[model samples]
Target: MMKIEGTLYPWRFRLVLALLALMVAAIAIRIVDLHVFDHDFLQGQGDARSVRHISIHAHRGLITDRNGEPLAVSTPVTTLWGNPKELQGARAQWAALAKALNQDPKVLTERLEQQAGREFTYLARGLTPEEGQAVLDLKIPGVYGLEEFRRFYPAGEVTAHVIGFTDIDDRGREGVELAFDEWLAGVPGRRQVLKDRRGRLIKDVQVVQNAKAGKALALSIDLRLQYLAHRELRNAITEFGAKAGSLVLLDVKTGEILAMVNQPTYNPNNKRNLEPAAMRNRALIDVFEPGSTMKPLSMSAALETGRWKPEDRVEVAPGTLRIGRYTIRDVSRTEGGVLDLTGILIKSSNVGMSKVAFDIGGESIYSMMQRLGIGQDTGLGFPGERVGNLPNHREWHKAETATLSYGYGLSTTAVQLAHAYATLANDGRSVPLVMTRQDNVPEGAQVISEKVAKTIQGMLQQVVEAPGGVFRAKVPGYHVAGKSGTARKTSVGSKGYKEKSYRSLFAGFGPSSNPRIAMAVVIDEPTNGAYYGGLVSAPVFGKVMAGALRLMNVAPDNLPPPEETKAAVAGESSKPGKGDRT
Candidate 1:
């Protein structure tokens, strides 16, 4: 068999040749596919192995108050980055980076060593120019820096709540910043970079996307007025040892917020130390029982319905009135024996006012309040505005009706009270309160008859100028009409009012004969002996109103001297049965 195999068959030899040919063709086909079919893909793979990329930041926009005063802005800074693969000795490089960045060497080492294969890592952010120069001088192979921007607030704490603050990435976090983030944060740009053999950026290939700077935002807040209100409120908080306070000034005709200040305001610059209470904008966010200040609304409703006259007499027995389990007592403790509608307002009598509210009925009183914008937001565009709490007429019990009549068992924001009082000054028209100026003035709804509004206005004047009334708030030369409110603050943990803690409030319009500005001042827990609104809050109202009135150049209603007006009031009072209007 071996001897025969020596002379091989022709067919077997042909098969061996065919197998060899197939192997050669397979190798040739692989070579052609690699060189021709995947030419672009191979080229791209090679380029990718040699090049690296990084991101760049764009500049943010400016924030200004209504008067073009800078409130929030951004400044250029440098962010230090490092490439771990390029760092030969991690420990040594981290020490050098720590010294340059003023950070812990251990922390830098951990950050650099944790991601050893990464091409990029942020070492420090928001470095000053000098610090960035120091890092650049080191000429470390792995270390690099990029120019970026960080937020800055020029007005600091003064405009903190209005202008708000931004985050580490220069993005708005609150207030106007959060409200207009899209318009304030500019579009980011992109750059293409080329890397060398050592995995370091050799040059910028090109700018892939051009950055568009953010649009400047102009707010409705007036910086000067903001500063003034801030200073005054801070002073009130300090001088009176008040727990907190707020002052709001409004343009009666335009409904623009001239000034709004809340005490204990925080500085957005040092936001890490901010407290929950300091961040609250009390004027817009807080609501409370308005106390005697709401009495005017009740009386106004009664007069509007033709159910009562200013001179009509109502018997107010003793100083207290028992309704259900609650007893309402007068602050002065004087028995308001026989008081007219005007006398009830002057004395702030709970019994007499309750009579008037009972006559108007719950439905009419609630309807009138709704029309006057009570229990509603004032449309001031402030974030977190409270509409206040007012129970429906059907929900009111016997005691609820009488207590609500004298401004209790209901809550209202300071702005709402000012807006409602403004309606009384604006000839019974309740215009929408606005924070910004509009191209066209918004027409208001008629909440009361003009005659009824005038009667209430006349009665409110007596609340400020009558003999037994708390009228020390009246300015010497200005005809002021407003009501005082001294309400015990409700405790958070208890149903009873806080001891020795009161919220003193005053809402008034200056030059009452032709009102221009309507203002409200609320002092929380004033420690000074004077806890009455007419005594504590009214003085602040007078001061702010005097400045605002003079700023507007409004003519004084009492052109005569201060002494002459007192003499006139005294002379008029000497005549029996002769009533004096404020």
Candidate 2:
């Protein structure tokens, strides 16, 4: 029985060895099949878990003032992101991660739960590198930090409306930022990287696309003048308790905007709770009736028609003129309302202007306003600029034309008004307004005859330098020319005008003998009981223009008799005489 059992065991052992050998051979064949025939498919599956293409945010452009002072710039930051799929199994560490992120664990967990099927989600954005590093220090699975850029404004709210602000993605949203967004926004890039099972970056595989930084932008703004204007305008706004305001200053020779500021501004750096009203660039985007401020220019139109002379007298008797049902009054009546053209301007007499408008007809006034860039595109390249209204009547009547005389029928913007005054400053030559610094100023068009423009400019000086004029706009030691306006604001939906609400305004240029700078100021709804342009807006213009003239070292044409003699003596003494030229 023992011999038989041993023989059976040997047979059984042979059969088991054959079965084991066959199994090893089948496994080897399958291994070769996977290694060669199905290699690409299997490799792709492995790569899907560990490889990623991440977006590389672009570095936005730098914005600077004409003097190379930094205004808008980009600073390096880090963004923390997570893979919801990878984070599914990372719940145990979510509390530690939430603590590092300064977020509630429950909130973080719930967010992850909601996006459990997603591959990526932002944990935090625009954090400092150090702050993001702290969150990464926890070594939590599925969490990562990425480099990014955040837009920063050095001037902050002081330069808010002009420079505008960028969105979180470093994209421009308004003002020059939006106007030249394509020039300022750089192209984004992509990168291929390898990560571990826990979503930790193992290595940078390759650059899918290299990021190109945006170009630098140099604006026409003079930072010194900008600060000065901002300070004065802000003080006036706060003093008068005004709702909003704008101040625009331009180079008379170049049509370059030197300093433009608006009140009720916001810090571009801090973008929370932003008010839409505060962001409007009132100088260009907002329009008003312009009120009596248009009198000087409109009178220029009357002169251009050759129907009225600077000394021509209009019988504005009874201190008012009745045109149809509208009764235009000279609230500032003098000598029973009989005034020459110059007197009309100095007194800002609506009755006189209405008579002039009636006599000259609306055709000439509308044509002149259009040439002044009113009711037409300023071509300033500003975003959201509204072309103010000027109706083109098929038949011009005395009553209809009267509206243009007092700045009631048409509307204009601060920028447009400044441009018109600048045209006078430039001897009737009008150039397109520009935001960027210019090496070669564009050729100006002769919108009005130089003689007529000079005559109007001379008369306007009396509106500021003459006795009983708008004296608040006077800059001592400098001859100034300006016009003031206090217009009743048109109610919402164009439902007539509001009796209590007034828009104060002033448009002028300094060194009237040879004007170099032109400015326009507008104060909306001054509530401290002083709503007139002479009281509220002229002071800002005077202060800002004085500082600007000094900053630019413009020669004063209105120095005292003694100072002028002294300056002349100094100039003669400094001269090298005839031999110096050779």
Candidate 3:
């Protein structure tokens, strides 16, 4: 057997053992220091790389009509974001991520390049839950999504002018949304969380601040009435081939706007194609000469001076009058021989109106206008609401005064006209117009004597009830009172007025005796050869009024139904011809 013998040195063996012991002691010391003395510091350094603070979104308030119908609401959404620096490192995943985001890869690369130093960038904001989840499923590095709220408008263009819409972050942008943004948008919250290297949330670390939900707002608008107004106004604008139109319906007793709608409105839900013109609330913002509708107010001013009575007479034989170089002419060339106050309204005699207003003087006219809330804040607090233009009485020339009597040299919004007519309908009491439902009736300021208001109301009723009246505005089973106006659009750059362009308007209320609602309809630049308010605007008023009265269950004031009038017409034919009578 071969035996192996080792010639080993005792000193070398002892040196190896000594080195092993030193290494073991050093390792033991390091373990104790790391576990006991520097544990918190080291742990904090590790967490700093993976832990992040995040925002918790809070939803905006809801906007509903008086009957609790939602006009505007918010829906849960997500915002996809990413660290551009980290995302740039994952070039191989860029094409897939771009496809997921529905963006071009080149565009994504350029965007990241543009934000080279940015640690964070938005890939997409206000994405739906499904869209965001589709992106998250890819699990690309540095890509992440956070909860958010996106505004949604259900009423679209129908209530766009009233309810408005919000921004990407759910901030109110227009209409009632902007008007009451603070009341609608609430505060956001914060949270701390642990995130994996791929930007996925692993666990919630701490809640920094709890979010407070926004309060809901209830408007005075009746969605049903609003829808009706929208449909009718849109139909009118299209039918007349008009540039734009507005309609306002008010509760005369309450001074609350039941419905306000404008044509040429845009869909608030999709704002990418928004135009500045479509965004305008024309009912509150646009103004024009009110034409013959002003005659009632002028007549009221004349009566206030005790210079005129409901039975008063004025000669309008010529149908044309000269106030300086301006030749004031009536719509009809045929002379209205003589007209009492009621006759003047029924005939819509511009000659008679000029005579009455000039006789009343400018101060009385201005006072009546001020009292009627013309050229004044509507108390709606709406953004971009114009007070319109009413020249100070002190600035009135003879020509201007004559023009003012017939609704020229002055401008007013549709809402202003509606409010003024509402005052007359409510027995000469003027109250602040409201857009929100009110629990208590607002105090009313008297603008005219109830006797005078009643008299004017009778005259207006005559305009619809008399043979040569605004028959187009008459409503069946209801005593309707209204005024029609056709004003030429003033030329933009210079000179007199546009030849054929006209603003057709109608303003009134019903049932005339116990007025429940007052409304105004204005159609701009009607081009379908029906430019007169009696022809273009009055029909809309009648249709809307008839439908609204029925919807509100208002008692019918007329003895016979309008449909019964067809039988009356048939009976007339059966009675006799001129030859048979002879």
Candidate 4:
């Protein structure tokens, strides 16, 4: 026993034990140093690999009509994304991934190789929920889908010119979509999410910021009236073989735009081949000489001056009037006879209007037109709204004054014309045009005296009801008051007007006994041998007005009996018309 205890093996065993103890003590010290002094660094390093800040998409708002009918809505969609850092090495599974994503394998390989260093990249955009789910079900590592909102239009092309459309990221691009984009596109959110090295989402850590959904917007349009107007206007434009056209309907009392439609319109939902021309909301954007539609304003100014009465005579005798070298003629009727101001309007006599203009003074004429919302922003807040041109009256020559009085030498949009006519219909109360629904309407300014306004409204009724006037503008059971305007189109990039190319326009209100609606129809370059506003535009007014009056439950002013009128109104309201289009 003494010999074994005294061996060198005993000393070697002791030394190995001491070495092992020292190594354990060193490890303990290092661990204490790391846990105390480098805690933040270690935690940060770990979080850097697993924690990621991600964006949470907020859906857009809903756009509805006055009746709570949806015009625009946000639809949930998925966008497939890939993490190139992980997907770059998953070449073997790429074929399956490509198949699930409905992409070519070769293209997938090229995309992955190109974005090898990127942590995130788009694989497919705007995919259906099922399509994205199928891609994800393949268990392809590094591939994920992001939730997104896409703007969709329920009313399609019929409301396209007004509602507009959105971009791929659900951003409003045109029309109402662009006008109220801030209220339509909501704010996105930020959150920290846990992810593994493969870039798969684990769990949401905490929300850094909350997302806000867009607010709902209600437009002033009545869908029923809107559809009827669209049908009638499209039919008119097509029947006349017009280059383009626009129609605007308004509630005269409230200044609410019930319907505003344009031809050459495109589907906002399907914008694959959208044309810029088709996208124009011509009723508000395009301007032209309003033709004889402006005569009422001139007569109003004349009446306000106390210089002209309804029966006041303007000698359109010889059917022509000469001022300097420029001679104006009444082409419609040249019978040399003294007629009242009402008769002058019925004939659309340029000579009579010119004579009235000189008598009333240009300054007086300009005041009423300006008050009627011409050459002004409509306050509708529509994007790309053009304020029409009104030249300074102080600089008006005799010729210019004459033409201005008869709806020339001044530019105006369909919206402007309709607004002006509505003012007259509402007894000279000028209300701001509203595009959104307003439960409490604003106060209107009296632009003209009630007596003068009513007189003009009465005179306009004669234009529709009078023989050889706008005979086609008459409604079956209502006393219509409107004017037909045939304006020569101004030649493009030239001085003179285009021959055989005319803009047919009809602007007025309905149920002359008590005006409820005011509308304007303008057909540009009607080429099917019917260029007269009475023949082309006035018929559209009759059909649409017939439907609109019934839809609004407006009592017929000239119907036979309640029972007979009910059948007529019902049938007429549902009747369809054809269009003459480009």
Off by over 4 Å in 4: 1-49, 206-210, 334-336, 561-582
What residue pairs are clashing in model 1?
none
Better of 1 and 2 by TM-score: 2
Better of 1 and 3 by lDDT: 3
Q: Model 3, poorest ten-residue lDDT window?
A: 1-10
lDDT per residue (tens digit) for residues 1-582 in model 2: 356754768988788889999999999988888898978877988889998888888898899999999999999999999999988887899999888889998999899999998878999999999999999898877888889999889999888999988877778888888988999999989999998866668999999999988999999999999999999999999999999999999999999999999988888888788888888888888889999988887898899989889888988778877766877787786876589999988888888888888778888888888888888898877888998898889998887688777788888899999999999889999998999998897799999999999998899899998888889988988999999999999889878988789999999998899899999999999999899899899999899989999999998887779988899888888887834755
Runs off by more than 4 Å, candidate 2? 1-51, 196-200, 563-582
TM-score of 1: 0.84
What TM-score number comes out for model 4?
Answer: 0.88
lDDT rank order:
4, 2, 3, 1
Ten-residue region with minimum lDDT total, candidate 2 = 1-10
Per-candidate TM vs. native?
0.84, 0.88, 0.87, 0.88
RMSD, candidate 3, Å: 9.0
Deviating ranges (above 4 Å) for candidate 1: 1-56, 85-90, 115-120, 196-199, 333-336, 393-395, 437-440, 561-582
lDDT of 3 by residue, 512-555 (tens): 97999999999999988788999999999998999899989999
Q: What local lDDT score does residue 81 receive in model 2, on the 0 to 100 scale?
A: 93
lDDT of 3 at 217: 94
Provide C-alpha RMSD values for all models, in order. Answer: 6.6, 8.5, 9.0, 8.4
- TM-score pick, better of 2 and 3: 2
